[model samples]
Target: MRKAVSVLLAILLAVTGCAGPAERQDLAHVSYLTSFNTFGRDAYVYVAQEKGFFASRGIDVEITPGTGSVDVLKLVAAGRADFGVADFTATAITLAKERLPVTTIAAIHQKSLAAIVTLEGSGISKPADMVGRKIGDQPGSTNQVMFPVYAKAAGIDAGKVEFVPSAPPALPQLLAAGQVDGIGQFVVGTPLIEAAAKGRKAVVLPYGDLVPDLYGNALVVSKEFQGKAPDKVRSFTDALLEGLEYAITHPDEVGPILKKYQPTQDATVASAEVALMAPYVRPSGYSGRVGGMTEERVEKIIRTLVEARAIPDGVVLRPGDLATFG
Candidate 1:
């Protein structure tokens, strides 16, 4: 009887092993978080969620609303959340301070969507003409900081332009009211929609256009979590790659997807956003695949942040700071 019982226990263990992680009692429970506004590339999470991609991959993804990208990273690093998406600026600053050892696993957009936008009717046809104009923007967001960086590239004096801090919602009001001349926008978010809807013609100043290189948003994991759950990590990325392919091939379908979650997103604007984001979505490649990061590209972004004083000296980390699956 003793031998028989022992044999049965061994069989059960083997069954558990074959069942894989999903059937395990202590399966990894993933909690994902992202800021509310920066939801273009990030919204692919919803695509995976709604289309059953995460379920297919054995990931239990729970999303939490974020106040902003910078805050989202802080929560993830604190172990309050599993993972989050954020721009390179926030991660680099924290990494420079060595405050949190978060590593960026995958870069979603090869180039930054950060842009300088103005109406065509403003008579601000070129980047240089931005001087002395009233620019509607949040006081200390990425725009306020990077505004000068791009302005100088266009030979425009950054200080000459006046910045009026406006909430994302208020931007349209300010522009329509003719209170502010122009506002900066990401290719995915409010600015693009407003441009298309209200005939808010904008001169898009892609960060890549000026710098020929930039690092923007990415999926980041805590150093500790990444070390422990390499398999789950890979699974998460594989699923996102699948969703990205869907988005690229079915741009028409994305508007419906966006409308489902954010019903406020105009289908017309959403369609335009889908078009704008195609280059970043990588029709064939994704964060899980290779060529996502080049050696020179990493160096260029790191060096720019360092020069901007966004990072400080003494931390040994560089652009290759994260674990690369491909």
Candidate 2:
């Protein structure tokens, strides 16, 4: 869904974005892993920096840009990182099956962000219309599982949509070239819409558009850190929330912040990204809200994973065992 644009931005942006004044708690040093591009999860860290939330709490935070889902999870489980931002499926499956020593602290994107995108003129308005169309998706990805479940339920045969390996950036090209009829994208919709609005004509089909709820972004702290630096983890979460809350309300400020943090971003591109992320900001009491989680949502994902064989048969997950939203 996200690619590493500039890792240096990850550190500087969060460390200096807008951290606010809080009582000096403890001078703690922590390394965290994240892969949600410069503007997604990375932006949350930047918001913390901008708000001065981290410093007020006396925490020295270092942010590292991770490559993909596997790399991010491995960084946390291997103890190379005290904490990480990752997906619920990868975290839960690893814990249930591989028994890795990592636990999620929060679910950032309460709603699934993955989507099947198409051009506006493609006349493919519904998921079922994707049948018999060439749909691009990263091979052997979490989305591969997600797409099939969605397509099947939509009455679109999974085998009917030709699956291909392609990332979000590649989708526009493949789509414009008419090489593929649609793409299952992970990043939010504005990028595709803007890409189309600017002439690409992409149509984004968010999973929530039809598919059942599937978890997206999340923050995870290692077992070592959980036992030793619970305060640190909690402080990080609080600082992160500071940023997230700002991003949710004052999205206009993000462009300049992106310019300062991720200077490489073009205004047009960043503007599109800003719009793309808007929908992800759930209502105060809905979706992945501040300190939000539901057993029903988790079970929906767990059952989906188990049904897909991502976890072993007969596996059941407990709330307190896998997540801690509060």
Candidate 3:
């Protein structure tokens, strides 16, 4: 009788596909950092949390907003966060070269959205025209850090242009009010700029057009975290990839999810921001896989950074050294 009852319990556990009590208690706790606040730009992370994907994978993810891409990398490297989203160019060229001990696990934006924006009637119609213009941007903004590379590729002397630093929220307003000739902003910020412009039209010169093969944001993990918790890293990245795929297919459904996290975010604007970011999230000429990086792309970025003097020429980085895939 005892043997029969034990056999019955084992069969029931197998049929139900349940884990043992010990397995149930071993969920991994992960801390994730975003490059910026909870906006439409961070739709994937919001969706992942709202939909229970992270929980389903046994990862308790704590997502935090960041000041900027560089800050995200710093936080992860310093062990404040287990993983983070940051600009690939900055990570590869600046942070990696400085030996910050962070490795990119996935490339999120296959193409860069960084741009130089001006009013439609402004004389800065082309990249060459930006040589003598005064551009306003927040200190250490992505555009400011990358503008030299864009200028070098466009054959413009970066030294000729003057950069006026302002608070981030005031940058678009400075351009709209004619306090500055142009602003350095992301193409995804078009809606915000339009809203700030009130009625004026804006002209955007995308950096991708000038600098070929320029990459964008990526998911990064500190070397310590990667070594200490390889399985947890894989689970977190897989869940994020799933979230990104879902958000891409259900663009109409992400705004409300994002609004849940950022109450002040406009649903319509959030949806528009997601749409603007769609192409960059998975560019047509991409390597035909989600979150995949190639040696060619990394090499081009390093070469461009060298030409722009963003890093010393002697600095060398290999793709395998800075990236990993599971």
Candidate 4:
């Protein structure tokens, strides 16, 4: 009887010892929130998840679609998500001024993709032509948020332009139906807009062309996460950059991967959007580095936000406070 009890104890000890290391090796759980629903612009995250980049770094990432950039920052700041991608120029800077404990870790878009789109024969050929024209706008969109800066830069009175608020999904349809003369949208959405136009060519006036050197979306992490798991933060950034580079180099491969993850997404449109975003992701004369931000570039973005009165004049932000590539 004593031998039987000893044998059982020995087996239990062996089983526990064998299971411990395996359990410890399980991937850490992490969540990433995107500024909007899964679109071609979110190729990096989709590719990273599909290609096992996050898993290779010992992270099991759960990607959630956001309603807008502000929502993404709010979610990350509240500790609801470990990381998020949002508009670094307007949304992140504004939130940072409000004393939210969030900082951008990497600049994903070296140039802004936000644009004012019009179809051919709309007679809205230029920014100034938008005056007195009803433009379709989605509340809280990056284009709408930064339109004031564009208007000021172009010497146009924003007050004269009637912005017809509509849901993002409804904007294109409304424009095609002649409800609005133009629409504020992203360059990546050009394909969708053209498709909606049903043979009418869409004209794009990219914000990057208007506001030179203005940065766009970025990967942001909560201050609490950065304080506690700095290594994880770094690891996540590195993996994401790898994914970005991969997507950039293999644009054709990205669409299928994205569609695999999101079956409802149009494959042709997704592919075209990826192609459109490549230049913004790695702009002309870029330093050939993924996820790099310069202090001057960041300051320019914050200054634009202030000049547009999007944030309070008293709000102060330094480059270090807004972002840290390391």
Query: Candidate 1 lDDT, tens digit per residue, 68-159?
Result: 44566777888888887766554666556656757777766666667666666777777777777888876545566566556656667788
TM-score of candidate 2 against the unseen true structure: 0.76
* Candidate 3 per-residue C-alpha lDDT over 190-296 given as tens digits, one digit per residue, 9 for 90 to 100: 87777789978889999988775877778999999899888889899989978887787677888899888878777676777778888888877655677777777
Candidate 3 weakest ten by summed lDDT: 18-27
Model 1 C-alpha lDDT versus the unseen true structure = 0.66
| TM per prediction | 0.77, 0.76, 0.86, 0.88
For model 2, the superposed segments whose C-alpha errors exceed 4 Å read 1-27, 40-42, 93-97, 132-134, 137-142, 159-162, 167-171, 268-279, 284-289, 304-310
TM-score leader: 4
Which candidate number maximizes lDDT? 4
User: In model 1, how large is the Cα lDDT of residue 252?
Assistant: 71
Alpha-carbon runs more than 4 Å astray in model 3: 1-27, 285-287
* Candidate with better lDDT, 1 vs 3: 3
In candidate 2, what are the lDDT values of residues 244-298, reduced to their tens digit? 6777566667667766767764545554554556555463356445646677778
C-alpha lDDT of candidate 2 relative to the true structure:
0.66
For each of the candidates, give the backbone clash count: 0, 16, 0, 0
lDDT (CA) per prediction: 0.66, 0.66, 0.81, 0.82
